[model samples]
Target: MLEKVIRSPLILIVSLFLMTIMLWSVYYGAFSNVFESVLLFVLIIALSTFLFLILFHNKRNPERKISWKSWTPYELKEEDEGQQWVTYRATRKVYIFFYFAIPAGLMVVAVFRHIEFMPLVVLFVLGTTQYGIYWHESRKYLNDREEV
Candidate 1:
């Protein structure tokens, strides 16, 4: 749908940008030197913990749903059975590649190169994508709810 296409790309792009900033900070500020590396490691761990807590809170608090009232047009409807099937298949592919394949490949490369930050970069990218997907799905669900 037009709404999905428009919003999904925006979510993906924003997530990628955020991840890039984090990666750049790690590479240029922390990983470049010994003290920087330790600082970066601590910062990354703290941020990761904070993110985990936020996500957990959002998941646990079911009453706070995404809002779609602000969305324009509001013409989108619930995905039909056939469309749902296609979405399921596409989601499976995305899950397999983004969640599993990419991380596995990155792990192999990190191990072979003995570079510590490579894995973290990969994880950051993966986390970004995961967050983007969650945002997109939540938006879609909210849109559908508004329609109904």
Candidate 2:
């Protein structure tokens, strides 16, 4: 999981760097603008395709190699119930922490760099939405548990 997180951000960083270069090249008219735009678009698409293939190929396997043994429905239901509440609570906490931390970090960086407010507002909204979704889901899970 740590490797997965690190790897994805590295890809994003590299992509951003490439995009910056492409933009600078276009601004300087070092290359034909049309050709540069097409090349950048193709690069982005190819990178996304490659990443998706690497990430999801395992889950997209056609072979059903693993078989499940029979179990009582009630037993399986109870097993799922045992972990649901704790899992939801943990997930909620994680989302809440990230929702605050990411924007706060971004704001600090933006202040240091004298960046504009529009990007910070966008980040704030995105983080708030994430927090809201996690909170709502966590509450629903808790309510469901109570009803049981």
Candidate 3:
């Protein structure tokens, strides 16, 4: 169970969401002083650094670093070249929404709610990084497919 969770990037996703919400709360006088904000910031940085090291660390064999079991939303089973190409294309399009639209929507909601800006900025970074990861994975998958 622990290994499965580690293999999934969902931890990173949840971590970002929680950290942002906490930041929003702390920054807007939810904690009564700057100490609380500083504490939250330290914790967020620590967690993010740990997760990033686990997610993107490269040892001797870089290809062995990432686990495919929980990285993608797709099934990614055996398929013909055409089918695989279609899957890759679909993944690309989906990430386009994830990259820009999601962050923009979040910011719009935040603005309406009068939330702090730092959280939204982190969210935008998360969105952009998620897209970059998805793009790199798609490219690698497509290239591996062609080689096969």
For model 3 the local lDDT of residue 133 reads: 68
Model 2: residues with Cα > 4 Å off, grouped in runs: 1-39, 47-60, 63-90, 102-113, 116-148
Tell me how many clashing residue pairs each candidate has: 0, 0, 0
Stretches > 4 Å off in candidate 3: 1-3, 33-87, 98-148
Q: Report the CA-based lDDT of candidate 2 relative to the real structure.
A: 0.53
Encode model 1's per-residue lDDT on 45-148: one tens digit a residue: 75575456545544665564223435431223234764455456445645765857586866676676766466656666666666556456655755675699
lDDT of each: 0.54, 0.53, 0.60
What digit string (tens of lDDT, one per residue) describes model 2 on residues 59-139? 554351111234221111223654565455646676676768777766776776654333444444454545455545655
Per-model TM-score versus the true fold: 0.40, 0.30, 0.41
Find the candidate with the highest lDDT and give its number: 3
For residues 3-121, could you state the per-residue lDDT of candidate 3 as single tens digits?
34544456556666666656666666656567666767777686777566555554434764545435554325325876577566656766675768676776676676664474566
- Superpose all Cα atoms of candidate 1 onto the true structure and report the RMSD in Å to 1 decimal: 10.3
